[model samples]
Target: MKEFIDYLLKFGDLNEQQISCITANAVETELRKDAYFAEAGKVVRQTGFMTEGILRNYYYNSKGEEITKYFVEENNVVICKASFDNEIPATSYLQAVTDCRLIIFPKKNWEEISGTVMIWDSLMQKIISRALVRKVERISPLVSQDATTRYLEFLEHYPGLANRVPLSYIASYLGITQQSLSRIRKNIR
Candidate 1:
């Protein structure tokens, strides 16, 4: 939970009692590779802070193909913001790309912490703002870039991630076929 606390500290100040309450409300959990942290059409009951491994946010396209939207790696928050905040079914899925360790807070406990902590809402806002900016920075390039360029940019942006996740997922994120990604990888080598 130290990792999670450290991440929170980046956003706002927290006294020892506040930190203790936050920690007390959180539960440490593991998600196995290929497991869904939150599935499409289901209400997300918990929000998590990733301490290890990776998760892919994805959704099925009209043709029933999975399209990876974003990746959440260590030291990041993993939550379907709209769904969690509104208590609605999620439009996408958060799946473990690798076995993951996370500190999770159920909706009730999260609310309790928010109510008890003076700076909780402000801290969350800062974190969310940062996440939004990061998301835009990561995704905007893919819209105009060619497959090869997108792959290269992905590597540059998330070093070592290409090797850590399945090529199929990377291909999906790049909006290219796995075969094309393989060819790109081969040519780059």
Candidate 2:
């Protein structure tokens, strides 16, 4: 919860009372490897602050290939905005890449918290906006850069994640085959 509170601090200060109010609604949740936080065809019912492990946001193509769009590491928030906002089925899946700990707030408590903690909505807006900007920045490079350049950028950007995540998932994230990623790694070494 400290990680979540610290993340919220980026928006503004929170008094002890406000913190208590917010914390009162938080619930700890866990996901084992490959567990889905938000599955495709299910509506998002909670917003989670990831305290440990990693999550991959992915979708399946018509050919049934998994296309990894992004990775959410520890100390980040996880939410399926489209499904949460529209109250419709999710198009993407948020799956745990490793055992995970998350501080979650159910949608049922949203009205109570958002109404009481005036800054909560604003804080979320900023976080989501920043994420979208980063998404755009990442997408541009994927389209313009070569696979090697993209893989190098990934290594630079994500640091230890290359070692932590499975090679196949990393390859999917790079929009390349596992064989190509292996060859790149060999050549680079």
Which ten-residue region of model 2 has the weakest summed lDDT? 105-114
Candidate 1 residues 49-98, lDDT tens each? 99999999999999999999989999999989999999999999999999
Which lDDT tens digits does candidate 2 get at residues 1-189?
A: 889999989878889988998899999889999999999999898888899999999999999999999999988889898888779999999999999999998997766789899888888899899889977877778888988999998987788999889999999989999999999999898
C-alpha TM-score for every candidate: 0.98, 0.97
Give the per-residue Cα lDDT of candidate 2 at 148: 94
lDDT of each: 0.95, 0.90
Tell me, by lDDT, which candidate is best: 1
Clashing pairs in 2: none
Q: In model 1, what lDDT does residue 135 have?
A: 89
Clashes of each: 0, 0
181 Cα displacement, candidate 2 (Å): 0.3
> lDDT value for candidate 1?
0.95
